[model samples]
Target chain A: MSSNFRLQITNLLIGMCRGTPGLTAELRELGYREQWITSGFPRDVAGRSHPVMVLASRETRHSLFVEVAPGPRIDSDRLLQYTGTTAVELRRGTNLSREQTETYGIAVFGLTEHRDTLRESIEESGVRAALLLCDAEGIRLDVNPFMQAALANIFRPLLPISWAGVPRWIPFDHESGPADIAAAVVPDVVARLLAGETRIDIAEVCREQVLWKLTTEAGKKRLRASVRGALAEAAGREMRKYFSVRGRFVEAATTSSDDGVPLEHRILRIVSRRQVQLLTRLGGDDRNAEDR
Target chain B: MIARSRHHLHDYLQGRMTGTSAGGTAEQPPPGDTEPIKTYLVEVRGNGVAGRDPDFSVVKTLRALVSEPYLKAGFPARVHPARERGLVTIEGRYRGGTPVSMYADCRDPRHWLIHTLAPGRTADWAIGRMAAVGTRLSRVSMPGQLLEKLAGLGLLEGLILSHDRRQFDEGGGYGAEGFMSMQLWGGQSGRILSMMSRERSLSDSVSLSRVHVRYWPDEDDRAASCLAEIDRDGRMVTRGTSYEGHLHLVKVFRRLYTRQIENLESHFRVRADGDAGKLVGRCLTIRPARPIGNSARFCDIAFSGTPPFRLWGVPAQTSGSFTRVRALDLDVGGALDCEVTPEFLRVFLLSGTSANSVVRFLTNLQHYFHSGVRLLDQDGQDVLEL
Candidate 1:
């Protein structure tokens, strides 16, 4: 997966949970810090390490580990090695039990077929766990109403940021996984969460946010520059078509005419060496006289 | 008696044969024969290869020389450009219908020819005028002394005394009293010095104006002057006059005062008021209105505003008739009434409010309108669609 795509997903997640008090507190209690680093090797006081991947956490504990690889798979050994936490659990095809959620906080696995089951378990337990789910190119899974409600509460309203191009709103009824869900629901959730009212429709909020971003100056400049650049490039190419190099001289064929003059006669005339010398001398004389 | 009669007939016949009136009457002297018999003469001048006929390359120069003088003298001269390497003819009539023909060498300056195509004192006077013009041209070609002489004659409006840095005011003490004094410096790098009232301080016994303008010729050989207006707090208030603005003022003065010393004296005053209405009109008419945001409002007159906000309000009237536009800031509750007259557009801000917010709103309104943004009317309907 591309880093930009990964970053976008990460940002969506952060934006959704950043302003939600309950979600932030819950994550904090569960040891999920903001912008937490997950690395195989560690270094000095700054917690810098090689082969590091960042996840939002609380203190030294992480509540989420987002994986955006092509295939949906769980490498439990690698996860355990990097995290260096024995409490980490790899839940495969089954949903987390109440006892499992209470005991283990980190879950690194695929969420394709287990979305409904997981949603049910989360609703039953009422405990938010650090959930990392891989559903790359997986079939659309149903989102339970309970999980939906939880997400709606956790997400915060978002202000328009510098996003170029017009917003493309995904169809509301279309089945989507965590990434799509985060993108669509987070902004509305954030808005509702800030407004303390859940009456606002998530779809409408999402569409409005898109419109807001499109109208921003930075967005407009980006779009205009893109269009202008394309046009200018086309014009430049057309201009170059008539220019040709011939031996020691570059000849530009006249493709335009003015004042009833024929194109042949309108070809730009080159100044001769003698004329150049004359002009130089004249210019020099004027400069010298001005100096005096 | 027969022989005497025959001699008279012979004289008559001889005069007739020579194409003269009978008995030499055609060549007879003027009625006042005692008066000096003056012959009217006119000189046609040209420049380029002194003795060669003007050709295609030198036609423009010869044509200019031949016709410019007559045109300057307020006569309509018809010029015939040389078809071949020969003479170019300029024919015109003097103010009193005295015909004149100036034949100029197409290839040479020295071979210019002139002829008085009519006979009379009027024709002679016209010829003399042409001669005087030639003399003036020659004098102009001499040193700067001629210009000084012309200035003395009140023909040159702006003649600065280089030594004393003072203008030669033709009307010695004209426009002397005022809150300001103006001195026009004349030279290659012409300067116009405007000394006006400076801000007075507690330490100073008397308030006096100082010469803050310094004009110098720039790279383009154009005169540039900067005007610094300082406030009471000793801070520069104005943007310091632009070179173009100085050039424009100079041009206006030149136009108004050309060859008229009295008008020059009365008009180019440095008083505080200084006939500002007329000056504003001239300035507005000459320069294109400055683009203020996107608003259709255009202003050329410079008016004072509160500190940090100079010329904030623009009084713009539509091109045709008088329509008073009241610009109300929806957010700030500030209003400015724009009165449009046939001569000018003037904006007046309502009292009891700071103009800063209102000015900003107006500027933004202009921008929005210019950018094709639709603005909502009082009824919240999209009325401004342009």
Candidate 2:
């Protein structure tokens, strides 16, 4: 996926998490309170600067710094500092020193390759968690996916509330509905997590609702039809407004309803009202001027 | 009968010569009508990198475009070159009627000025020809095609285009009139915003509009002004001038920008490397004025570098007595008292002023200072001296 797409998805996730009460409650239960999610912070802290996405504590006590699309090899040290932790262990590469890891009290998890390690570390640390979420299919560029079994096993216990399976590329038809989906699924995922469900599958819910499909082809026709309907409705509204104004002008020209007032005066009254409205809308300072 | 006819012919000849006819009706004189010649001035300034080559090339191209074989055959024309001054003169008449002349001056490589004089329909035809030439030259992707096009339309000229990467570079200011579109990156957005605010505070004459900004997703705080429009499309659409139009312009710009941010593009591509240091500043011509001080009115005072040295704010001093000195604060930080006398204006650059800061100060001085004022280097030469 392109960087812009990733950014949009990240923003969507943050907006969903911030807006949902149930999700916030679930996060508070997990001890991740005072959530501060941002694309990148302006200032550097602990000798580290802007991270791709960060969800930090209010007082910088604990945080989750997410790198959505990881490169070939992760910069574990930088990642750790961004999370305000002294040390972190990656499943594929070097692990943090035991003393340092114990002192920092935070474990970093890469969802793709380090899923098994992350699960073990989470159980061992029993403190706070930072996660790197990616696709399991690895169909998108710059996204690394772990094996399905590994993801299921790791997430089964944690029961994390996620915006996964919403489609990496959102169709134009679904533009108006993403926020709505986010609002709905965020609370649902939180409920599932609280219930200790084996899986919290948003994609399954989307599939059932016919909002999306596991196979891209099944959703194409519906998406196109929805987009077409929206455009037609917008165009129809514009035409109606245009014709209505034209009809009013025609009626005003033909009718002699006003009591002996000249046509010029009647026309001026209508025009003057419109002019006043325009001036008011534009914040003209001459508000006290007579309409005539 | 032959003698009578000869006498009549003689009478007719005498009538024609003396403004009278055989039947005693005075002969009507040919129409005595004179049309004024319209003059258009075009000044071209290069983007420092292209040097004078672009300006010279444009003039040469214009001459070639106008002096096509068909045009010469259709109209009485003469084309000549002054190799010494690198100028070309084209004098011609349209369909053997109205006289027209074009003088392209390429004496200064950094600056080229083209002057055209023609009467009525001929003037219109010449301008049209120049526009056609500009359109053809625009395809080459050379620096100065936009300026040339503006010149063709008889718009304002002498606009400096700078994409200079250096922090304290020269040539950064808006012209009295010109068009510029730039994609500012990283911290430059902050600088532009500050400049815009400063310009807003300083003068109401300057107008900036059609601005679009996009924040970096990874660094949301660090936004980029991605799209700026100032007649870059060569549409000749004038910017908003009336107060209502200004309000509307601002509103439209804000609404469009917000919409763009909400619906981001599918793919994000950074500006191309080759486009680095592209021309990004406005070009302005200096109007002439009488000398302020006791010095010779036309003496050349050369400063070491090019004009418009990235100065911020207008020059504070005006022509008057020195007793009532104006205390001025520099944009780069620091205050100085300025003394403006009829003979000369003296500026005191306080201690701890950096060279670059001084250059910036001088740039503004060149622009906003008295028209007669010229900055001289250590050698007593004009700053803009070749």
Candidate 3:
């Protein structure tokens, strides 16, 4: 990518989220200040009054993010002040005067995804930290430090995780959850499809699906099971496609059943099997695989 | 990786400039102390490695001070290289039980604090921490490169880290030796702790938060730094010197290192390497002084060779210094003129005499502790009781 793109990505992922409220003092002691960060302001900065980032001297380790979302275009007046930022107050009736309306959404995912990113990164580069574009286009996965690809590329010879953690890629609703949000406007999805109205407002649909999925344990289980089955089927299709290469192959001198199998078998046995196993374990538990 | 890490380090050093969030000041020097003492309050929690890159990690910490009002050049007594030179020496199992290592001459302690983390579990853990702070580091260096460079230099080992600048001949010089430790930081709260070189460039003014350091160490790790001066073999290696084999690496204490600097109260925490039961290094802080007697010269020695030190089978260079060796004495926090005399070095370095263990022996003696100045008697045994 271009240098600016790389810089922006790096900053977005690492800055703005340097410290948790309680952990600021500890981070500062190590010489990393909050000023180095260019973006990713926390929801409630502990010290400031206007969501502005606190500048740390160069001797500091943790970077300073002026505003969690210090994008030249983004106005962060009301999103929320994080450890280094001040909160912005908004007047109810007044229009978002240029500066106040720039509140970009900067939600930290997982538990304290914001707390320890820098400390961990300094000790090891294998950790993953991501800053993504969170909008209706299915939530741009953005730059994720936690993923295998980036970690492997950055810190060669992937180091094992220090803690036992589930290998989870960023959760992406590629299909935009279910066709449920528009169901309110039109109860039957099939009827809407037949009536030539197929575009669904993904944001609304995902919200409804999330609510429905959270309604009861059984409902969530059912949803998980169907997802698992669908994932398994898709994986199977991929496996077949990989193995069924159209090119011809020369006969091997030592023809053997186990050793002679095409490369695809080895690929499936090693790589795809992992995908299938993970899907079975998670999908089955998360959704009602039996019911599906 | 070094470049990227350097970029982040440079940024961090800069960030240290604006360190105003510390909850309180560091521990103050005892009352009646003539000079102020600046302690770097650091806390370390992991077992990763911090490199000895003179150009990057080492210098960044000191260079960050350049932005401050402190004037680095034309330092008063001791003459140092343009770069804040440093040498790492381990006193394994010799630090009187503290597995403490010394990165001598470090003016800034926080940078040194980050370098003390040991190796292993570093790739994931260390890198993750850097990325979190938006830090990019340089690529890892390998042994062949180290060896080639060593061969060219007519040195011994093939391992030359990017930072090692020493030539490994009969006597090693001030350079990067492969036998160095890694730097790291870890914890639930994700606090930082590290060990840096003892040698650093001084700032006109020191960071207040960096002056006092404290940490609730892991008990075992506590012993990691609790060193024993005398080893089991009692071999006269460089127990306190970073370069143990060589007899040339020296720091002649012209005058007791008595700079009356301030003690900006700051607390710190750190982790020690797991190689317990082994000695590491030792550290002692000097209260800033109101200039003391001139010609008060002393020299520290070391050895970085075999037959003397092969503790873990992986030969390590002996590094560390004699504890509390008085370097200077001046009335700090005061406004007054000072004087020096030729008799200062004469009596300080003289052999013992009767009536009094001539206190003058101090000019060259590296004392275990400092209590003003004293002349010693003949045989260099008893104090002159002057």
> For every model shown, what is its TM-score relative to the native structure?
0.19, 0.25, 0.16
lDDT of 2 by residue, B258-341 (tens): 232222111111111111211111111122233334221111111111223221111111111221121212122222222333
Candidate 3 lDDT at A8 equals: 27
The ten-residue window of minimal lDDT in model 2 chain B covers: B265-274
Per-residue lDDT over A5-36 for candidate 2, one digit per residue giving the tens place of the 0 to 100 score: 33334433342333221122333233332122
Q: What is the per-residue lDDT of model 3 for residues B178-222, given as tens digits with 9 covering 90 to 100? A: 123222212211121111221232111111110111111233443
Better of 1 and 2 by lDDT: 2
Which 10-residue span in candidate 2 chain A carries the lowest summed lDDT?
A242-251
Off by over 4 Å in 2: A1-66, A70-292, B1-37, B41-59, B67-78, B82-87, B105-113, B133-386
Ten-residue region with minimum lDDT total, candidate 1 chain B = B279-288
Compute the interface RMSD for candidate 2. Answer: 28.7
The C-alpha lDDT values of all candidates are 0.28, 0.30, 0.21
Docking class of 3: incorrect
**Model 1 stretches astray by more than 4 angstroms:** A1-5, A17-33, A36-63, A86-104, A107-292, B1-386
For model 3, the stretches where C-alpha displacement exceeds 4 angstroms are: A1-99, A102-171, A174-292, B1-159, B162-238, B241-386
**Candidate 3 Cα deviation (angstroms), residue B134:** 28
Error of 2 at A111 (Å): 11
lDDT of 2 at A250: 13
Task: Report the C-alpha displacement of residue A124, candidate 3, in angstroms.
Answer: 54
Which candidate comes out best when scored by lDDT? 2
